[model samples]
Target: MASNTFERFDLESSQEWKPYIARFRQYMISQKCDQTLYTAHLITAVSNRVYKLMCTLCHPNKPENTEFEALVEIVANHFGPKGSVVAARYEFRKREQRLDENITGFIHQLQLLAQRCEFDDKLEENLRDQLAAGVASDAIRQSLFMEKNLNFTRAKEIALNMEAAANTCKIGKENTIDNKAKINTSSTKSARRSSSRCWRCGRIHDEEPDDCPYLQFKCNICTEKGHLAKMCPQSASKLTPYNTRKREGYVKKRYHTRFSNYFGSDSDSGSEQSEVQVIVRKKNKKRQLRYVKK
Candidate 1:
């Protein structure tokens, strides 16, 4: 609704700078660039030059944050018609300090001016008045010093507004149904038939089965229709070579003692000694008897 949305930053009083700056600081804080974000004066100088060129092309009745098309016109006028300002700014700023305070001040002033005009109000009037009064004019002219009065606070406020607008405009994914992969009743059968085709064998099949032409091995080990080899407890063990089915009758090793459940009747059990005996007889009629396990 407002073509001149950027005109609100100009203020008629120097006192307005404080509130303006406060708002800008708030914006910078919100953007998370309050202290962390820093740029060399070279880039600032170039941007300043480009912005000036753009302003000249627009010839706006007053300071304003020009639209994209206006900016394009300015850039075209600079490079395509008038001359290349980028090269000049680059050449000039290269000799200056990268963090030149003068450059920073100029950058800040331009931003303040832009901010002053970015909204649909007379905020720029105050800024223009301060400029005309020559108060801190040198600082404002200095690209580095101008940074002190940035309009980040207002910009951040504007950003927040834009973010809120975006949120309102958003169609949340939770509520929206994804149309991708949606099936049409007419094509259901065809889609399914096409998808069932075996990609590896290039064979069109309705299913994945052991008898499928794409089947790999013919060994019983590979047959899992009635039983899987790994799951077949009766299968021969590679470690023993004995079929587990055949070894079913064999007793597994038992850890319990045969006499463990048979407790002695009295203290006589302690004195009682169990023994095993063996006898050896030689051809010379010599006999030997050995008793063990006492």
Candidate 2:
């Protein structure tokens, strides 16, 4: 097996010493370094401050030499998870997944925080609860809560599946609504096109009615076919007074007959007679007609 080079350790930045030492230990294990040379190798890899401290404690002139196990314990006591437990717990409790954040990223964050907590057997259960609490979606939370045997691995799987399903459903609904809007817009355009009337001939057509053959034959004033009355020079003169009076009498007689039928009255003598005067007012002129009903 190839040996891995150990990175030098720093003592001034005590916060990073724990992981640094852990990695150094792993490298030592892989290299199968002997216990007798463990302290010597560790002393060689550390910064000046740590190197001087180790030299003072394990010098040959000293009364006592520090053991490798005791050195490890001293480093751990000074820089290990003990000092970070409260901060880790605070962060874990405050951790919450954002709606836009992926569930994988949120779960990974929870895992890192759980490591610092050092919950022992309760680690898995605490991780599960944190995972459930941090999820942005209520549906996923409900699904996780419904599980009787929830664990970190199972919770991750279920939460991922639920988040995916929710996204799919949201996309489907948006697509459906978009399709409906498009259909409605297309139908409105079709209806408007179908109901369109040509300005020239005043008739509905697929194309403009200006080119129609009947357009030239139709009259504007009388609305008749075959000729335009306005263009015709031989127009009829106005009616005479005698003909006008005769036309008025005919209209008056027609109105009386229609009203009598509507009232269902036949015996002229027994029924009471009432006069309904209709006044036709136009501009500044007024014309009145008296209808006698029995």
RMSD of each: 26.9, 12.1
What is candidate 2's lDDT per residue for 1-294, written digit by digit as tens? 323356777766644766676777788888888777777777767778776665565455321256777876665665552757888799888999976689999988888888888788998888899988888888889999999878888999999998788889999999999999999998887678558865545556554455544566867656666444544333323211221122432322122222334345453645554445444444444567666565
For candidate 2, report its TM-score: 0.61
lDDT, each prediction: 0.39, 0.69
Model 2 whole-model lDDT (C-alpha atoms)? 0.69
Q: Residues 1-294, candidate 1, lDDT per residue (tens digit)?
A: 112112133323333423543554455455555242211111132335444554566675322444433443454444545434455433333332223333335335544444423333645443333332322323223432234444534433333444455456565542343433344543676668657745334456665544455455323554544333443344433223222222334322212112321335632454444332222233443545343322
Clash count per candidate: 40, 0
lDDT over C-alpha atoms for residue 132 of model 1: 26
Which stretches of candidate 2 lie above 4 Å from their native place?
1-7, 10-15, 55-64, 76-84, 205-294
Best candidate, TM-score-wise? 2
Q: Which 10-residue window in model 2 sums to the lowest lDDT? A: 236-245
